[model samples]
Target: MALPTNHSLLLPALLKGSKTSINPSFTISPKSPLTISETFSRLKKQRKVGFIPYITAGDPDLCTTEKALRLLSSCGADLIEVGLPYPDPILDGPVIQASTIRALTNGVNFQAIISMLGKVVPELSCPIILFSYYNQIMKINQESFMSALNYGGIQGLIVPDLPFEDIGSLKKRANKKNIDLVLLAAPTTSNYRLKAIVDASDGFLYLVSTTGVTGARSNLNSQVQFRLEELKKETSKPIAVGFGISKPEHVKQLSIWGANGVIVGSAIVKLLGESKSSEEGLRLVETFTKSLTSALP
Candidate 1:
């Protein structure tokens, strides 16, 4: 499919220029957060394992999403992945798929997320990584999308289903904007593929601990320890393990095996999914995030 160059068509609500528009209070002024590379390097020197939590934007509501983001940052999150609500999510399991559906049903989109982030990013201490699929990225186009990232203080982007062979152009564009195109490395990836991923992925290589789609599990894939060790041998860049990470014990185990960070998603998304009110959602996020962070070295 051809990407639409006209970004105005990307989000009518955002470009409408009303009080409900994206720039109601925050202008499209560039306010970039720290780069993902710098954040990982800083953590490496500090000898701290980064904790990145994933949440769906506008899940309970967009307003609640903002509060939850701030709460996560304050709760010791090194980075936050805000899943841009898409009609189709390539890698999401039921928990995240349900959360994404909730947000989309409430009118969350690429532009809405950018609008929400514009006001929320300035207050956040850590970098924000936007998790989006390929078509959604194309819908916003490249340059305008990068501009929106700056406007929203987002520092990283993850296209979960993007082909490794096709990442050249997008990765080049992201590099120009200092936005890390974080790539995933699964347990089944061969060393040749892993080597390519090491060279291509910025910030850190996202090691999917399981072979299947993302969801919380009682225990992690036992092969993750060996995979972490193998990745450490091949690349100097940080390695952050994600997928099936739900428990503090999982976080501790990853850290002990030399992981630079851990990304927890379905578990946190589930917490906010059950919330009856914004307050309850934020409270659940805070308590659970603190538990995960405390387990990290």
Candidate 2:
């Protein structure tokens, strides 16, 4: 599919201080305030595809989570998705569910995650997108949650459980704080609603590869390519496919299918948990991120 002249898929913001991100004419903020669209537009200009990896904060401990986050950015992740351990993760698979359990058991809550990001965000090269459930935000109220994200210098958010039709006030609050409220689209979404989601979403639109929860799969659903093509016709927003994407080949295929980015979650979570130590886990994450990113066009 030929991309719209004004709608090419873009890259995440280049790391601050890196030659790629430096511009002599303008002053760059200490904290990267790059919106999701700006980052994707950069990616598009560079002809690079996005690699987003998800990890549960405070999986084993906050200290480890901090290290892992730094490793993800330095490695190859364009945007990192940091999952807040919620009591109920209906959209997550067993691997991600186990990660949430470990995080919750280790006493990681919303406040604790915020504290961890406060220290880690300053050191990160790429933007952080917090993955949260709608209920968690409701308990504290949307405005409070947005305030916490802004305070931590978070650039984006992915609320898997929030419906696009009902995201009015929540999205408004996020916009006020300059936080991108990324909306998700499923293969099952109807055409009219898909357009609504595309119009409402900031940063980029998440396209779920399957109808089920997040996990690594041996084979992608055969219809995913068709869905990607279908969505591209509705809107020019960057489309990122998530859920069940595990291998480099999957990333390559999605790129061919017109995905601006590919989000890998359960695979990274499983890898982190399987590692013997936090240091090793960090190494594994960095290595895995590099491998997947290298596959991007």
User: Which candidate number would show the highest lDDT if scored against the true structure?
Assistant: 1
Q: Against the true structure, candidate 1 has what lDDT?
A: 0.82
Predicted candidate 2 versus true structure: per-residue lDDT over 221-297, tens digit per residue: 87889988887776778998999999989999889888999999998888887678877887787778888888888
Query: Could you report the Cα RMSD, in angstroms, for every candidate shown?
Result: 5.8, 10.5
**Which pairs of residues have clashing backbones in candidate 1?**
none
| TM-scores of the candidates in the order shown | 0.90, 0.88
Model 1 misplacement above 4 A: 1-33
Per residue, candidate 1 scores C-alpha lDDT tens digits across 74-182 of 8888899999888878699999999988988887666667767877787888889999888776765665566567556688899999989999888887777668899
**Where does the lowest 10-residue lDDT sum fall in candidate 2?**
8-17
Off by over 4 Å in 2: 1-30
